[model samples]
Target: MIQLQSIVKQFKSKNGVFNAVDHVDIQVKKGEIHGVIGYSGAGKSTLIRCVNLLERPTSGKVIINGVDLTNASIEQLQQSRQKIGMIFQHFNLLKTATVYDNIAIPLKLLGYSRQDVEAKVTKYANIVGLSDKLASYPNQLSGGQKQRVAIARALSQEPEILLSDEATSALDPETTDSILDLLLEINEQLGITILLITHEMNVIQKICDYVYVLEKGKLVEHNTSIDLFTKPQHPTTQKFLNTISQRNLSDSLIEQLNLTGAVIRLTFVGESTGKPLIADVANHFNIQPNILAANIIELKNGIVGNIVVHINGTPSEINAITKYLTNNGVQIDMLGGTTNE
Candidate 1:
């Protein structure tokens, strides 16, 4: 439903022209929750802003549905923007306006009749679970409730696409989870496509169907959440995954170890997970395996698991075990020690 082609947004700096968003392309399918992730100053916000022409791209195309927004006239662009709704990290609600009035602002701006505006605002307020708070003001609501007001206002336009630019970054973990769940429900029930920009992997893991990794204003990698978690290709992607996944043994820990066996880390995915494969391997090779650390996380696709173990055996036996694990779809990495490849 949304496509960005070779998008570039440059700014004039004292040193020279610097690109906040370099040449990049992204395609978000209809009815899917696509996430854009990066650290601070990585141009994630710039990229999302370009979608609604909030920051006009210095070069390339911004296409929504079938319309090329980059070249559209001012009137055309304004009309088109009505179908695209955006929410910010800070709830941009008018403090003086009541909850009902905040949600009715968008409809009123479009010149809707009073009866129509009230009807639609009531519907959207219910959708965001704020029906009871209609008479409340922004100051009286919690952070989560304020966000609910922003969401209801965004949906007041009945947008086909929702752009969330760090919408959950300011909330606590429990509040964040609730907001993500609400977004998923909006996607499933309202059939609206969502493009979320976040730095937190947990947020993406909970709701995103696909993810695009951004670093230094460039598209580093993009893939389904399961595939990306199971086998991240880019070093940047690996670093991000390590933040949520179990950390590797530190050099200090490794130095303190007093084992003479080889240490290996195994990653399992899909059909290879949830099995006593470690025990079976030790039994088959007639070698004892000491489990060091392990963790299993469930994703949309399936289970992705990791295990670290130390084992002692002859070179020939280690070689056979490596081959056996490889054939059985287990990824083996030599963390430390001399192990057969």
Candidate 2:
């Protein structure tokens, strides 16, 4: 429902002109939660801002539902923006206003009747689980509660597309999870297309259907969340995935520990995650399998299993085991191991 085509946002600095967001293209399908991820200064925040023309691109098309926002008139852009809501890293709520009023502000500004404003404010406040806190001011609420207020305010606009610019970054881990869960529910129940930018892979892993990896203002990789997690192509993407998965074993650590035989990384997807492939390899190959590190990630699509194992066996035995595992739909990476044919 949202398309950002060849987007470029440049800024004049002491060093000369630099692209905060380079030529990037992103398409967010309707009703799907799409995530943009990058570290600080990776241009993720700038990229999301370009979506709503909050930071107009130097030269690109910002299309929403087939309307090129870049070419839209002032009135048309203002009307279009009403349907695109945004929440920020810091809960941007009026401290002087109560939660109810905070949510009602948008409706009131849009010239809704007093009764209609009350109805929408109440409805969205409840949707964001802030019904009871409607009377509370910003200072009286916790970080999560404040974000709920922000969400309620945004939803009160009845936006078709929700842009979350690191909305959960300021909260604690537990609060972040709760907020992410709330966003997932909003997407599923309201069918609002969500485009959120976060540096946290855990957030993307939890709710995103598709993911776009940004680095130094460039779109390095974009793929289904499942594919990105299982098979990350770019080094930057791999770096991000490593943050969530213990798939990397340092060469020095391996050397210091003097790990023997072959060291391999195994990836199991879907039903393979439930299989006894490790056990089968041991029994069938008559080789010992020592697990170094492992983790199971539950994605929106399915479960992904990652295992790093140390094995001691002859070349023939290791090859046989690799073949056996491969035939059973397991992905094998030679971490520091005998090459598998």
Candidate 3:
């Protein structure tokens, strides 16, 4: 239930005026986890900040639930912001305050009653699994525990939209997965709309329903997480996917192996991932398939598989095999080497 229209945020630098976030448009539906991904300095962090007018756009509309935040009055904007919660890459908690005080402080400042503040803190601390750590200060907790405190503090506001700005980047892989799982639970159980910006494709792969790919302050691609992962169109997007999937083989490795025949990259999505397509091809066609690299990933939608293989066969036999695989819902990309065309 959030829409950003023609968003542009420019900054003055020694080089002159530059758009940190160029003209971009984004729509995040209610109760869905939408992700914006880009490498460092890709303007993704700046883009998410514009959602809550934390960084006001140069010229664009920031609409939340049909209200144009760009045109909102000071009081209105403040009121609107209370409905939006944000967590940062670094767990921004008061170091001296105990977890209970850190979560209760925001509610206290919001004019919540002492009893109400205690209740909200208790409820959210339990939700984020920090009930036992309420007495511990930030230094006494692990990185994951600190983030849980941050999450509990944010949820204390009862926000409808949660903005996560690289929330898991600072944690280790195991801790990252646990934090992601917690976010997924918050989205599913609380029905909160989550808009997270991360450079990690693994994060997007795990929880995002839809994905927006940003590069150098512009929107390059947007699609369902399944479609984007299965068939990445942009080179930048492909590079990000490669980080986690390893779908492409290095040319040096390919050359060193001295592979023969047509080298093909086959992509399998959903049900096709379970089929014996390679075996079927070998049985039906007079071709020998030598698999080079294979990877299967599970996304929010389902499974996607990427297999690189070298097929040794005559022109007609290779063509027949390619056609057979294509007919069975396999996407084929010729990496290098001979093909029937």
Candidate 4:
């Protein structure tokens, strides 16, 4: 397990003291993959480095497996860090070294026996599907293969936690998916507590069981992946969700034109039965809603849905329908056209 309490990291910049990570608190439970997301300059990288004492926090606690790393001695921290392995966005490998040696480096540093290092190097390389590339150099491998080599290197040490800092950012989409799948597989089979930091919401959505949204050194929102995806509360969080499910300005205008009256965004989740509720609205109000843009992304939670619709009816009728829909557990936001909420 990993925890950061009021973690702060500041650097003396030309303009002033710039805080890369400010008063941030995070807890990554054992056996769960937690995601941290933010745009460039959002301090996500700095925050992760602070975790293993790679970069010391100015004032805070970095606790790993019950050890407070911030206050730990160099010897203590070094020993603790061996249990926390990290991989970079760029595969930081010795280009001339074979994949076998690349992975063996970490074990070698720990003073592992030559035989033990060889066994682990081979085993981790195989785990990452690089058995054939053990003798291949970094330059000869593809981006994904190189990343696998890096992963094998990190896992070769057999760390309890893996801090993946934008580990897939440099790869193509196909390769990105492959890397993410591998991370998930590692988490599932190895039960390694992973803290994956990236600007990519899609990555977080795919592998993260829980996620936190960070902006300008502050925690904007944090929740389980399913809850955050279905019902994002913060504006920053909404923008991140919209990155993958972008609703264009032109699309909004089209919905407005088609509806020509009241428009509402409807969301459905657990205990909010949408089919019967919509049927009841139709029967009671004699109004049909022209559904505009609709999307249903299944999460670990039950099927959650969002739809843009134009309800055609008299003013009073629309008001009645809105009230009826709300009483049934449908979360409706009046992204209105002519109607005022």
Candidate 5:
């Protein structure tokens, strides 16, 4: 539903031009939750802001649905923006306004009648699980409830696209889960296309169907969550994946340790992964392998696991075992011990 091409955003400063976003291309399918993740100053917020023209790009195009947002008139842009809703890290609600009025603001702005606005705001509040909070003020509510009020306000517009800028960053883990679950329900139930901007991989892993990894304002990696988790290509992407996945060392790690007679790490995937591949390999090699440390990842579709083991066998025999395992489509790495985050 959204397409960005060669998108760049630069600001004039005392120094040379600063590119908050640099030639980033992202395509978010309709009704899919697309996540953009990066560390601070990585241009994640700039990229999302570019989607709805909150931050106009210095160069490149912003295409939403079929409209060319870059060159659209102010009125047209405002009209198009109504189709997209956004929420922020802070609740951004009027402190004196009741939850009902906070959610009713958008409806009132759009010129809805009092009865219609009341009915819609009540419905939205219920959707965000805040039917009882309509009478409460922002100061009287918890962090989660305030966010639910923000969500109710955002959704009150009946937007097709929802842009979340660190919506859960300010919440606790339990509250974060609730908010993520609500987003999931909105996507599954209402088919609202979501563009979630955050620095947390755990957030992406939890709900994002697809992800775009941004570093230094560049689109370094983009793929399905499962594919990226299983085989990370970019080094930055690998680091982020390791935060959630099990960390195992490779042949280089073992070599760095400088105490490897024979050491190999085995990776497990899918249903057969948890089974004993070690025992079978040992039987074939006529040697018992000493397992050091292991990590297991039960992903959305399947499990991607890793185990580090110290091999004690002849070079030719161990090589034969690695070949056998590789032939079976198992990933093997050499390591001394598990690497630290």
Candidate 6:
């Protein structure tokens, strides 16, 4: 439903030219929840802004539903934006306007009739679970409630694509979960293509079908959420994964263990998760497997699992065990320990 082709957005800084969004391309299918992740200054916000032409790109194409929005005229761009809704980290509600009016503003500006505007406002307010707060002002609502108002306002236009720029970052963990759940519901029920930006990996893990990792304005990595989470390739990607999982064996632990035998990181996906894969592997190879650490989590796609183990055996036996696990669909990575080979 949305495609960004070789998109670039550069700014003239006192130091020199800076590219906030470097050459990046993205494709989000219809009804898919796509996530973009990066830390502060990662260009995620700027890239998202390019989607709606809020920040005009310096080069490349912004295509939505096969129409090149990059070359669209003012009126065309305005019309196209009607189908592209955006919400921010901060709830951008008019402080003085009531919830009802805040949601109605877009429709009203589009020349919607009073009756139509009223109907849309009420409908979206209920959709975002804020019908009771229709008369409440921005200051009267909690952070979560204010976000609901922002969501209602965005949905008032019935956008086909929702761009969420750190929409849940300001909420507490519980509230963040609620907001993520709501986004999932919206994607399932409304079939809106969602492109969300977040610094939180857990948020991406919870809702994204596909993920794109950005670093210093460049697209560093892209993959299905399950694949990326289970076997992240890039160093930057690994760092992001570390936020949700304990990844490294401390120098002290390695030293205390004498760094003998092979320490392997095993990742399991699909039906392999929660099974006695480790025990089976040990028994099959006739090798002792000392489990160092393990983590398992359920994602929207499937169960993903990771485990670290210290295996002691002859070189041939260790090689055979690795092959055996590979045949059964376990992803393995040697994390600096002992590999007889």
Clashes per prediction?
A: 0, 0, 0, 0, 0, 2
Clashing pairs in 1: none
- Candidate 4 residue 236 Cα shift, in angstroms, is 1.5
Q: What TM-score would each prediction reach against the true structure?
A: 0.94, 0.98, 0.98, 0.91, 0.90, 0.96
Residue-level lDDT tens digits of model 6 in 1-341? 89999999999989999999999999999999999999999999999999999999999999998889999988888889999999999998899999999898888888999999988998888988998999999999999999989998899999999999999999999999999999999999999999999999999989999999999999999999998988788898999988888766766787689756778888889977867878897677777798888888677788888888888876677778888888888988877666555
Candidate 2 Cα errors over 4 Å, as ranges: 337-341
Which tens-of-lDDT digit does each residue in 265-293 have in candidate 1? 88898888967889898788878888888
Who wins the lDDT comparison?
A: 3
Q: TM-score of the candidate numbered 3?
A: 0.98
Report the C-alpha lDDT of model 5 over 151-241, residue by residue, as the tens digit.
Answer: 9899988999999999999999999989999999998999999999998888987888888999999999999877777667899888886
List where candidate 3 sits over 4 angstroms from the true fold.
339-341
Every candidate's lDDT:
0.89, 0.91, 0.92, 0.85, 0.85, 0.90
lDDT of 5 at 8: 98
lDDT of 2 by residue, 138-202 (tens): 99999999999999999998999999999999999999999999999999999999999999999
lDDT (tens digit, per residue) of candidate 4 on 238-317: 88877776322245685547555677777777767447676677778777787777776555335566777788676787
Assess the local accuracy of residue 173 in candidate 5 as a C-alpha lDDT between 0 and 100.
91
Model 3 over residues 142-204: C-alpha lDDT tens digits? 999999999998899999999999999999999999999999999999999999999999999
What TM-score does structure 4 among the candidates reach?
0.91
Candidate 5 regions off by >4 Å? 249-258, 262-265, 283-287, 298-302, 335-341
Better of 1 and 6 by TM-score: 6
Q: What's the lDDT for candidate 6?
A: 0.90
Model 1: residue 11 alpha-carbon error in angstroms: 0.8
